[model samples]
Target: METLCNNFPSKLTFGHDAKRTLLVGAFALGTYQGVKLTGNFLAGVWKHLLRPGYDLKKRYASDSSECWAVVTGAAMGIGKEYAKQLGRRGFNILAIDKDESEMEKTQAELSRLGIKVKTIIWDFGKISNAESYEAFEKELKNATNGLDIGILVNNAAEFQQESLDMISVDRLFRASSVNSLTPALLARYFIPKMLARYNNGLKSAIINVGTNAAEIQNPRYKFAVYGASKAYLHILSSGMREVWGDKIDIMTAIPRQTKTPMCPVDYCFTATPRAHVNAILSQLGHESETYGTMTHDIEYYMRFGMFGGFVIDNMIQWLNEGESKKLISAYERRMS
Candidate 1:
């Protein structure tokens, strides 16, 4: 009985020690995560709020008229907004798109900004056709001749919201061409020129517009091709930054849903094209990769970080399913 009493007190003491150890471990982990999250939050605040964007005018020569800002997919939506904003900022604009009439309209709008506006009507979807690409190259060279191009915005992309089986081979090829090949080739063609200008003491920048869908860790249901292609662009931009970031400012702008013809939804979180472009422009040289707007950043963390993978995955599936229903309904109505 005496030995049993002594052993019971020892067991109780050991249990107490184990509980204490667990509590300490949990506290330490919580504190570490808290610190990490706090640091990230403050860094974001600094990048988005405190830091001012680089003076883009300084990128030009003494004669700003010689400098040009090249923007692809510039006929409408975010690309058009980028062209307008860049033109307003004193840079002559070279708007490239497949739609001639839309390009003409964009040119008219930009011309009112009093900056020189030029258009190149070349379809990026024809990237697989060697002869077509060569023709586009010639046209681009001719258009940019005698002009000091300072900025390149690779904003052209083909969005396909279909499952793998539903996606047509032609569309797959076109998406690969437009979403991946065009940006890669454009950067390859322009980087040397940009480097030459940079060597001559001119600043240069490249903004490769990507999508938030690329960053999601979960399976992107109908966005297999689109997401992967944009992911390629994002990584390409990162690689370019590694190689040429010192001389030229290279950034990837990843925006969420914005109110555009491509994505016509006007949810509370959806950004306007002008506002989205403004947010992206404000972060140039400040961030290598950005969500483009504060709302998107918040949404990203909430969906991916706080809500976890299961929630986000289901949410995405639901949204994509809803979009699929709308598309099917529209097609049926057209047929009827």
Candidate 2:
């Protein structure tokens, strides 16, 4: 009884000290995380909101009108806006797409901007074939002869919104070609030209359009294959930047939901094509990879933060459910 009484106070003090230490450590950890998030948020505001973009006209010497910007999928959506914006900045535009009528419209708009505009109606899906790709390369060279190609925008992509097993092999192949192979091959073709331009005291840039879905660490539910293809694109962009970033301005513009034909709904976070393109262009020469908009930057941080996986998973599930309902309703209406 004497021994127990003698040791009780010391043992009690040790337990109390341990609990207090744990509490202090947890508080310190929470404070560090909070500070990190706050710093990141403030930096994003400065980058996307306050900071001025690099001057394209000054950088490319717009007075000459010899610099050209080639844009794929330039008939509509984000690609169309990129063509318009680059043309407005005095870069001649080479617009490529499968839709002849749409491309004609885009060409007309670009011509009205007083910049040279050329449209090529080629099926991106066809470029999967070796001979077709070689032919396309020859066409590109012929079309841009006597022009300084300053920018190449790889913006064409096939969006697949189905489960992996449900998607057709042809569809997946086409997506891989458009989202993965096309950008890689186009970069290979353009890097030499851009480097040559660099040797001649000119600057060039390549912008590869990617998807935010590819950045998620978890497997995307309905768009796994699509995400995987875009992930390959993201990696390719990074590698190219590592190699040629100093010589040429190379960047990957990753956008989330946007108001385009592929995603028609105007959600709260969805940016218009013009807004998204403007944000992306503004970030050029500053960042190797960008989310393309302030809204998207926030969304990216939130989705990847601690406790973000649970929320994002639920949100994706809800969106998938909503999509299924829409498809079912359309089917029923057709049957009726």
Candidate 3:
């Protein structure tokens, strides 16, 4: 560094003496043989070691770097988009679907991105015979070596055109199960393990895909039965956000009628599922988070993507010390 400091004037004497003093200060008494390093060299080495990509930093160590993201309904539509984007970001993907063929197709897609892919054929619409937690725990074992799930996206859903009066009790339950109940079960199934991992201090995220119908209150797009089911999902998600601590991020995105299978032919053109995928990928795991919007359509206009994050974050911080009611009240108040 003295040689590197050639441009300094006859402060050369000061530099030389300072280097000698630091060199002497390095060892308890004196220099080790003739090879002595100045304190400046030690500070430089410390800074370099802490810098990004340094081997000593361990930023990319297997323990820190591997991410396992599991997405439901990932065979196509928004879920498929989530899987591809996450895989492209180097996350190993575990995708699930009732359709074995589509699961296989996503496996191929993830593979092409050089991401290790695992396909689990399970129907979230039906509760597992085993408890939901055990079922997911079992699936996690089949997917990865341990319990470090980086993210979970609940996206599997079905839509119908039938009116509430025309829909049967069983049929309503079926649609409800696909859109709401399964997500709750998957949350119950995944949250304990997620919390445990987070308590042990892991970085993880949970994304619940909600619908704009939940925001509109008794709207008529997908179906009345389905809309009411999604309304239940909104309350349930807010409750989960309450329990998942700050270290673990939990968010529900409400995208409107989209060019996706979740909506029937009538609603596709108004919403673009792919564009919403970009909006969501931009929001996830980004320390800058967004929150409290009943609809993703409104989220598009938020400048503080990081704002409202604390709405949930504060709840997790004090462990049941916060409420989504405040957020809900504010959003609803704005409507009038």
Candidate 4:
């Protein structure tokens, strides 16, 4: 290879890497030459591999969106799911999230379910006072212009892992605005519209994404402020259900640790945004999972109550052990 390259025009090999590239190109002109140029060939290939912008095209689904059923946090995790799930049940979806790229991916997934979609990328932080509601109405007026929605899912919430005592007051307010205030504002704004429409024999529903972390006091997940805020969410949902008087369907869901970015990977990622959307749709179709289980309340209690505590206690122990599988098994048997 060196002998043959020595014979090539010297000008073609002016620079360091340029010389090597020219030699390799000459060698590729024949199999005998390529074999003689093993070191150069491999070196050239390796250099190209190391360089960026050599990315392969990813095979993808046809990207599409549904212009109805607006869901917040509609990017990579659970919120990304509303479009797909709702679309399957014959509702168009308006998937909203902070990440436009991921939202497009989710929109494509839902579009496969044959639903039209629209997307909005906006920040929705909550406030404690009545002004929160006004802000939500304004946001709605901005993002959704004359769009009809059979369902609204407020699935977006800000999350982080700083010690509650250490985070500043401004940080605290920011979280309160994201987790508690935004949902409340959205509920306040959307429900009245839903109620007026419901009188015309249309049934509209609202779902507030609640949490299991708020149910316990723990050291590992030091979101004390966030936990306290979630308590307000739980109470607010119950109050809304009571006060709304069945005119608007409201449901609160406490999904276990999902495999979302905000959550640690140690926990199971079952309750995706897609699953939540499906649960809502199933409820709408009048299945046993719908709205309240006034009919199945007795059986649900008998079945889930006993094991729920046991499962929770053991899970807490496992996650606290740094999500170690070995520690979890030991903890489970010990609990048994």
TM-score of every model versus the real structure: 0.88, 0.88, 0.62, 0.62
TM-score between candidate 2 and the true structure: 0.88
For residues 73-175, what per-residue lDDT tens digits would candidate 2 score against the true structure?
A: 9999999999999888778888989889988887888788787898788877777778889998898888878877889999998777666887778888888
Q: What C-alpha lDDT values do all the predictions have? A: 0.82, 0.82, 0.61, 0.59
Q: C-alpha displacement of 41 in model 4, angstroms?
A: 67
What is the number of backbone collisions in each predicted candidate, taken in the order shown?
Answer: 0, 0, 0, 14
Error of 1 at 203 (Å): 1.4
lDDT for 21 (candidate 1): 97
Model 4 scores worst on lDDT over the 10 consecutive residues at 54-63
Regions of candidate 4 where Cα sits further than 4 Å from its true position: 1-67, 126-136, 216-220, 268-280, 284-304, 307-316, 324-336
lDDT of 1: 0.82
Q: List the candidate 1 regions with Cα displacement exceeding 4 Å.
A: 1-14, 60-65, 216-219, 307-336
Candidate 3 lDDT over 1-336, as tens digits, reads 888677667553557889888777876444542233355345334433332221211211137556678888899888898888777666777888888987787788778778788888876656533585467658757665663576788878765445788766766667766887778877776777777776666656778887765665323432466667777777787777676646656767776646555432332224566666655655554322232112432333231123344454343334421222333334345444
Range of the 10 consecutive residues with the lowest summed lDDT in candidate 2: 323-332
